[model samples]
Target chain A: MKHVILGNGPTGVVAAETIRKMRPHDAIAVVGDEHERPYSRMAIPYLLEGKIAESGTLLRHDRNHWIDNRIELVEARASSIDADAKSVTLSNGEVLPYDRLLLATGSRPVRPPIPGMHLPEVVSCWTLQDARAILDRLRPGAKVLQMGAGFIGCIIMEAIANAVGKTGGSLTVVEMGDRMVPRMMTPKASALIRSWSEKSGVEVLTSTRVTAIEANVPHAGLLSLVYKAKNTKERVQVTFGDGSTRLFDFVICATGVAPAIDYLRGSGVEIGKLGGIVVDDHMRTTAPDVFAAGDCTESVDFSTGELMVNAIQPNAADQALVAGANMAGGAARTRGGLRMNVLETFGLISTSYGQWWGAEGGDHVEVVDEAAHSYIRLEFQDDRIIGATVVGRTHHIGALRGLIQTGAKLGADWKARLQADPNKFMDAYLATALSLA
Target chain B: MMNSLHIDASKCTGCLQCEMACSYENHGVFATSKSRIKVFDFHSTGRKVPYTCTQCAEAWCMHACPVGAIHEDKALGAKVVNETTCVGCKVCTIACPFGTINYVADTGKVQKCDLCAGKPACAEACPTGAITFVDASWTGLDRMRAWAEKLDTNAPTA
Candidate 1:
């Protein structure tokens, strides 16, 4: 039996492992659109700016996951699917049939229709190819303009600033938000980020919208940008945001991405409201014998149990394992993947697990350490640990992650313990890790 | 025989072992961002090259500093940063073409590779031997010797 899995992203990687463990005799093949081997796309900005080597982003750890699982990877895009025939047509016109099929088509970069956006310098993150192309032109003193305030946007902009600053490269970050991390951080938290970002010589312009993307293509000069603030809509020579016009050598669109479900469009696979394949708790699609996971599918959020598009890497991997197990004739169910994101930005590490909004509508606890330029906040309701955000000192994020994973209660003195010392919080994390609490 | 740290960018893996070791040796923290020596990753070519102050004897950074914060360490034959007198003006940072000297916001002072007073910690920590604390005057001696050995005068013309 040929086990054909669509998309070789994180989900497909884990699914292969589960399938190999259960059905060793069955032949496994992974189809992917990416030319390069599976690499950490999140780490590309760091790779581009010369913080981390590109090879490191290729994921050198646990080297034998694909080969050991006897998974044959086909590096080509899937054009379309023949659901009735249990076959998939490749971009190169090859059709491969499958005994068990898993659609992990993943996602692609979202390019908004804006003027001068079609230029070569206007880049986006869908692969390392774009990073490599941008890195080739990135030099000391080269100016950059970013067009989003999301996680990928923040990380890439930070990396660019760090890299360009390594050789005295100047930068400007434009965000159409009230705060740096509007969705993730509170106003107080945003102030802390704003302060830290300013100290690092990063010009973060928030609550401002980019109206146009100008180009100086042949001259290789900086790009001229126009923007107006959301509240005031005032036009000022603010090189940061509300400026007459600014110069930037290049522009990166970190806006967001959409699920790649073109293959399964006419295959009777139902897409959710978010344009991802609709799936239940078990990762089973509307069609029997067909399953989907990762950014390509609408997964149940373990935190809210709501059907959402959980495109984060961890959720994708967990769902793949569950999908593969059931496909390989094992009694395993996805049970939904958790919508969690753990990130280290500008020396400040933040982790979010479960519901960010609680009964009191995100009334949270915060510990601010001005001396250390650090802050930690935990959003919760009742006894359940919903969400957490931390900025500055991050010596013990792994331990904190364990406590969130266990869904452990903070006990009576949780607030005092957290504010007094991070060591106490670390102790709580260790206790959770040890399963003693 | 004044000595300096020689960097061979070709061999760098960009693992940042040098940065961590340098930061820990000088600042007592495993902070890469704070390190004087930086590894520049060229993602397109898949290259990681460690960069740092070359410690020139007639250091432009020394001459360019209005406050005379940079001076030659007679014993080590290396330019040492006098943090006490240094005003953190970043003039040296601007004057230096290589952009090695940088201002540390935490300490309100400019920091750069000081050759660990004589012995280099970056060279010691470099896993691939990309960096080495060799005699400054004869930095390329080892490469010369390797090439000299390969010149097979004894071998017949192939």
Candidate 2:
């Protein structure tokens, strides 16, 4: 039977590998838009920081390896699908018949429609082409201006600062939000990040919003940023969004990425409200023989039981395993996957998993460091550890991860551990259990 | 003879064991971003490359320094930067083509991969065998072995 999988990203690749392991004899084909072998998407910033060389971070296996395992890899864009006929067409007009198909078309970076966005220097981060294009503009003494302060944006600013600053180039990051990494960290955690950036020599502008981008010319060699700071009525040319209108050689908008699903629209496949393909518990799509996984599909959060879009590598890997197992006639269910993110920003390992987050909650606790720049806050409801953010010396990050994953409820005495060292917080788990019993 | 650390990026899995290893060794913490070794991702090309200081034979960073702060370590043959003497001028940063040499504003020193004083943590922590420490003379031995496998003079014809 012909089984086709779309996209060679984490989820699609894992699904292909899993299916082959489950049924060795089945005819399997993998379709990918990218011509190169599947590599890790999470390592993009490190590449910019000059940490690794150009080709050092390849995936575990290559296309040749997959072919050796009896899996056909189609290196082309998949444009449309015919669910009724059980087939999908590539951009080259090649149609392949399939008994089963899985959609793993991942996310694209969200590019805001600001003026002068079509300029050569202003670009967003996502695919390899985007990275290489940015690299071309990164000459010695060339200034870099970054827009956005989310996880990818914040991390790349550090990378760009390190890379450009090494070459005598100036670097600045402009963030519209009052705090950086709003989705991943709380205000206390963001405070730690702000301090770390100060130490790293990266000038960050928070509580500032960019209103327009202009291609500075005569040379067309630099870009100017127009922004307005919070609690101010003035529209200023704060070169990097602070009252300093500086010329920059390159401008990278590391805003964010959304799932790529334009191909699945007319196929009668159910799409999620958040722009991802809809899938059930087993990662099976509404179409009988079609399955989907990765950033392109919606998933249920393990703790909240709420439908959410999680386009990270870990979730894709786990979901792919389930999709592949069921595709091969094995009894594997996704159950649900947690949204886990682990990032090293400035010099701290910032992380968020499951529903260890939410903007609105009645129960919460705030902790901070006045001098050393550290912060940790645990938000709870009904005595269960619902969410937490640890900033500066977060020693037992794993313990929080464990508590969130297991839905463990904490006793009142556990609050005392906040005064104790973070590393010693794990020791409080048992004492709290004892006191409550 | 001082030996330079060699990297093989093709085998990297982006597991970050190398970065963790380096951070733990240098700062007694686990932070990949602060580590000397960095991994770059070419997402569309599906490439992740781990890069660090090549420790050039004729080091430009050493020559570019005004106060002779950057020097060569005889034991590991690494270009070492004396943090105490560095003025954080970043002149060497401009001279280096690869941008391996970086200024750390926190300590007011320039930081680069020192090969961990000859025992490189990145090479040790690489789980996929992508990086390994070897003598200065035999860096091309792996490539030779790969080519040697292709010789089929006496092989049975399939």
Report interface Cα RMSD per prediction: 25.3, 22.2
Question: How far out, in Å, is residue A80 in model 2?
Answer: 0.4
lDDT of 1 by residue, A252-332 (tens): 777778898877777898988988999875667887678887889887765676788756765665567667777887655
Q: Tell how far residue A266 is off in model 1, in angstroms.
A: 1.8
- Candidate 2 lands at a TM-score of 0.67
* lDDT (10s digit) by residue, model 2, range B7-95: 66667777888888987987788987678776655443455567666775535456444344677787787888876555444445533
List, residue by residue over A8-94, the lDDT tens digit for candidate 2.
766676678778877889999988887666655655665666665445334432337676778787988888999999999899999
Q: What would the C-alpha RMSD of candidate 2 be, to one decimal place?
A: 16.1
Off by over 4 Å in 1: A60-68, A166-168, A217-243, A361-363, A399-401, A410-423, A429-437, B1-158
- Misplaced by over 4 Å in model 2 are A61-64, A166-168, A219-246, A358-362, A393-396, A411-425, A428-437, B1-158
TM-score of chain A of each: 0.86, 0.86
**For every candidate, what share of the true interface contacts is present?**
0.00, 0.00
* Location of the lowest summed lDDT over 10 successive residues in candidate 2 chain A: A228-237
